[model samples]
Target: MDKLLSLCMIVRNEEKVLARCLDSVQGFVDEIIVVDTGSTDGTKEIAGRYTDHVYDFTWINDFAVAKNEAVRRATSKWILVLDADEYLDPSEKNDLRSFLTGLDAGQPLGISVPIYNCVESVTSGKFIESSAIRLFSNLPTVYFDRPIHEQVVYRDGELPLRSYPLSIFHTGYLDTVRKEKEKSSRNLNIFKDLKGLEEYDYFTLGNEHAILKDYKKALYYYERALTKKTESMTIFPYCRYQIVLVLIEMKRYKEALQYIEDNLKRWPQYPDYYSMKASVYVNLGFEEEAIELYTTALTKADAPAGKDKRFWLITPSLGSHIPLMNLAKLHQKAHDFQKTVYYLSKLVTMNVNDHLVLFQLLNILVPNESVASVLNFLGKIFDFGRADHLVKLLHVSLLLGNKELCEHFHQACVKQNIEMLAQQQLLYALVFNEPDRFERHLPEAGSGSSTGPLNKLIFLAAIVWKREDFSSYLSPSQDESDPSLELLQSMFATLFHPEEVGVDLPFDVNYISTLLIDLFKMGYYDSYDWLIQQYPQYYFILANILGDYFYQNNHLQLAVDYYSLLLDQKQLSGPGYYHLALLYLYQGETAEGLQFLRSAIELCSHESHWYIRYLKHSPATEEKKEIARQYRDRFYPYVQINVVEQLLKGQA
Candidate 1:
């Protein structure tokens, strides 16, 4: 077959990801030409496995020079430029072939492939997408430009380019990779040493400085970029946005607000500006203005492309999800439950795959709504027939300790005949408090290299569960042991094994939370007070979990301990107070109980059934009746809800 596309890449010390990148485009690209600029690793050898057209080049501080060297060696109609850290989506290889075949290669055409730069883990779906002209015709007139932040250009002028439906995932931007490679420092040095810096060059410098947390330098360069000829730069808006972001990072929200407002006038069609302005308003304590601006942002953020070529939509979510999230949080803080759910639910619909969105929605719904109502809401939003949705529901339900809902999701998963992953099995076992299921999946689930800390926590759970002979599940050493797990181990030793070490908790919130739930499950009331005393900081975080768990389970004394702690720390919610009040009332602590109930009624919803419940728990006093009547305008709605029977037909 005559070569239609050639893959050109310049690399050094990319042995870890080189083969994977090459492997992705193996049969798709007609030829592969890898230019090695002094790799001290197996990069050359790995490139050799995929192609014979490997060439060596002397290391220059110039990326363009190396890239042009690689491009000069290509012998094909089209050039597909890639970095060693980037790869085409293997499934989309056919689309690339079709795209190349259909294009008129003789024209000054270039395809701007969206490069998804992974910020954290490449597999973690955390990435930023920027369109780059990575695929272009291999004409003699075409070559690379710039020493750093290089781009392909015609010898005469810029090439005509358009966005395409193809993806290239890059991992070089990841924190681990950035730290190891020090690429930011290299780029910064290149920009610093460049003789005649341009607008784009200044922007690149801003980016590098921002990445290094040198905000002062970043803003200086970004301001310099704006002072240059930015009329043709597609990254102008990005540079502006970066300045705002950096200002936000530096807590200069007022200054950031000025910039955002100025940018909005110049680029009013841009939704991200509105979103950024909203954020500034939030920081400036203009909550209502912030909400209104966010709502405005939502209406305009759905443009399929940038308003003009001089802009790029660098942020994926600033348009919709970001504003939605901000609105949800704002409303939540305002104690407007309905508005919070409304925004979060909208977010849920938009981002079906976003676990955090769905989790927040669940958190809002689960506490306020009935189980059946929550189930219906889930059904409306998610197709539980899908294994992924079911799995998410199951995970969140487990987190919420809603075992009945977990069981429902689990059964639905089984009906779909989905074989649970090891982690899923562990989650299931953990939430359901199923020791046998935990035993069944522990080995495979515990064996992962990165799961050592989690596995140790699981090992501690096994101890709590009194799993016989779980020594095999323990990792060989505590080399990877979490301090949280050790704290748990110490707590266990102090309580059950009195001859062992005393509790010296370097308190870990997550593990302590897990311990509370586990102890609550075990009905080990003795452990509760000890946990509370050992970790005074628990009042802020874990105390609620402790209070809710004990309260919901009707563990009177344990509930009293945590709820009282919450009260002492001023951490108790109205619902929390209601639970504690009930506990105290049941225990004949009448004075404190009545006072707590009154406070609950005062702080909680006007529509709260607690008003009616307060009325019922009487050896009725005039004061209690008067309080209820005064606060609650009508008992009719409440009594209506509580009644199970219909009025006799035609009785009225």
Candidate 2:
């Protein structure tokens, strides 16, 4: 007898994962029809191992044509079409087999099967499922049309169809190995050729362009598709969603907001619509509105209990944590210590991994009584085997003047054999004004070790500055004849005036300057001034550091002059421009500050790292706020600035 169910597939170069898919459905389906369109890989050879009904067809520009051809070759009563990257779970296969047996007894014209799109290897792999029609009768009553998004065309009479509970594990969208852009590019060319085919065809073309990351072209096509007016109102929202996504990508948040408002007015039941709306508010620096929408979305997820009957409807499998995380991030950015802690506590209650959330919380929370509380909280949750987290925790503890906590974390780090932890521990000792602890750790550094003499000398300088013992350390080091004396002199100059170090260690220049500031803040100005005079080359560094110190201390004009001198130095570049821009902001020269800001932005645009930091730390004034906004909107468009706004407001 003929088979009751047939598995139809069209593939090219899918040899890597095709066997796994075929093996998944082997026991459930009775017939397998594999169609190949010029695959040079061993895909055809592999397909022969599974079935005898393998056939080749000429490559066509239309996917629907290829799929329809594959479906026509099925010799069974029912056809189930799937991609090579898709598979059937064992339980789902059993469900399908049972459904196939029932269909054989009384088969419908078509059936809709559920498809699950799963994102794996993120925080955790979980399936997000949706439904689509993939199974249908092979009778002449049902046919497919269009090159893409082919719909089931029924005869003018009442057609029989059923929604099956069986699900297909769809990996096609999640499979990142396949070059999606190449596929989209190929489809886009075909779409352009068939521009006037139909309104639905134009929408498909727009989707194809959107997938290819050609937002401008995608927007043009989607607008043209909307003009057709032949498509249903329900279909209009999907096109609008795509258009809004493109607008967001282009940093056209205002236009995107309008599209979202129109979409929500028509279909507020769509959960994704609310999520997109929240995203727009985030882009436009409107955090309160975004949070309101997110809270509404969360309420919709849960079934209504009390008299609040006006909540929006939400779909299943859409988790509330996605928006909650965004909200927490907003609070953190605004430096609202209490609210940041509150959100983090809520996140932990939701069964989130507390370690991750707590680490982020520590980064945002101001160092104080809460710092000790957070450190203790972290110790209770995660193991110290992770050196990075332990080191970070140690840094926070030291900053908060929690010596006991710092010592405890330092012991944990020592047990973990973390090299960087030792350096951090030394710095911590200096910061806390503990000379005995610093002396004890000083001898631990050796010549060949990663923690070497140079780092040790820097640490000692900081410790001496803290303890007012610089005279003892620098007494013998003033003699110019000894090699160690020159080393000491250069170290003193570099530590206090890093601009003297020149181009050999460009990155290290900032490191030295930061150490000098710490020493100065600890009241070691006498040694700082001596080093500045001895190493005249470091005059620029001293000037810049003093400029920043004065600015922070509210001596704005003096800071401006020092920064100007640093900028005027010959061959000055990176640090020079950055410091000058900051000084201009302090002096209320907003236009000059922006000019320097733009110069810094251009200089660092090609740098792989630190570019974001460079842009973020540059001061913004009311006169230059528009310039700052434009730069942020252009370069870092993905960041949600309303998050920053919400944070600032919460802090206020």
TM-score, each model? 0.74, 0.55
Segments of candidate 1 deviating more than 4 angstroms:
13-28, 38-58, 87-129, 156-171, 302-313, 368-372, 459-463, 466-510, 517-652
Per-candidate clashes come to 0, 1
Model 1 scores a TM of: 0.74
lDDT of 1 by residue, 1-652 (tens): 2689999999999999998899888767989999999999998998999899999999879999999998888889899999988888888878778978998888877788778887756544556667789998998788888888897888778788887877888898887788889999988777767888878788888888998999999999998998656856777767878899999988676577778878889878757788887876565445666889988777776554453532225555667668888999877654566898899898888767777777678766765678888999889989977888887787777655567777788788889887777766776676656778877777787666656545544644554565535644554334433553445455444434554543454456665676666554434445444555556644567777766765554355676776777788788778778876765666677677777888887786563346544554544567665755553354333223212012111112
Candidate 2: clashing pairs of residues: 334-647
Q: Relative to the unseen true structure, what is the C-alpha lDDT of residue 73 in candidate 1, on a scale of 0 to 100? A: 87
Output the number of the TM-score-best candidate. 1
Model 2 lDDT tens row, 83-182: 8878877667777767776765233477876666554422322345555567887765666666766666566665566788666776655535435426
- Candidate 1 global lDDT: 0.72
Per-residue lDDT, model 2, residue 328, is: 75
